[model samples]
Target: MGLRKRAAATVVTLIAAFLLPLAAQAPAQAAATAWTPGISPLHDGEWVMRDIPGGDQADSWLKNCARASGIACVSVGQGDGKQSIFHLYKCGTRSLSNFIDALSVLNNQTGGAEVRFTGPNVGTYRAPANPNVIWKFPNAATYDFNTMSVC
Candidate 1:
């Protein structure tokens, strides 16, 4: 091949080598931004739950939810006296519903901690002491839940 053609080919190859990785990374960067908590409205199926009682049990629940493939993001914050706050974002309806189910199970297994949730489309739910009882929020998009002390 001619030297000019070779040089052009080399330049094109170098450009592709430099730009391809960046193009591949663009989606990941966008996904990271999309998952950022509280930056966007919850209308896009994002959700947050706060005030979950902190302890071994809460930790287990958080871990389980984080492991779930449907969950997009999970954030936990510490509070006074083993209490905690949790924010779950970019969750599908099925995943969030399943999470609530699991949380009810956890509540019952933990001897009935009062779990309260607050958010858009979701009303405040105060879980009773019965294991069979589950709070129902049909239209809830985003919510926060915490364990309330029963005194």
Candidate 2:
């Protein structure tokens, strides 16, 4: 092959080598950042969900929510208590934090608003507003949640 062609080929190869990894990481990076807690609140009511990292943190948050009044809180995953907690105070579709293991959902909206969980394949689960109640879903980690709705 001619030198010019060889040089151009080398440039193309180098560019691809540099860009491919970035392209591959783009989705993963977005996914990582998208899972940030306290990022999106869908509704105009008091709703909270904690993305717990470990069983220990889950236990702690559950106890805390039990004592809190007039606020709905949900907890997901058995994480290290590093993920942010979600807050919703309206009636709309709310984005969810990263799921590690397990889940707890609470609906504390006034006028009997309901909280709904939608998964791509697992369908939807709805919980009505119940004060001082925590809806625990231990198998929530297996489902891929698309959006959470409160109405």
- Give per-model TM-scores: 0.35, 0.54
Candidate that would win on TM-score: 2
Q: Where's the lowest-lDDT run of ten residues in candidate 1?
A: 91-100
* Model 2: per-residue Cα lDDT over 37-75, one tens digit each: 432654554545544554666656655654544455666
Cα error, residue 80 of model 1, in Å, equals: 28
Against the true structure, candidate 1 reaches a TM-score of 0.35
> lDDT winner among the candidates?
2
Give per-residue lDDT, candidate 1, residue 98. 18
CA RMSD for every model? 12.7, 8.2
The Cα local distance difference test for each model comes to: 0.40, 0.61
Task: Give per-residue CA lDDT, model 1, range 1-151, as digits (tens).
Answer: 9999999999999999999999999987765432212222344543455545545655555555445333322333322222222333332222132122223222332333344444444545544433333333332223333222220
- The segments of candidate 1 whose C-alpha lies over 4 angstroms from its true place after superposition are 1-4, 27-105, 109-113, 120-122, 132-139, 143-151
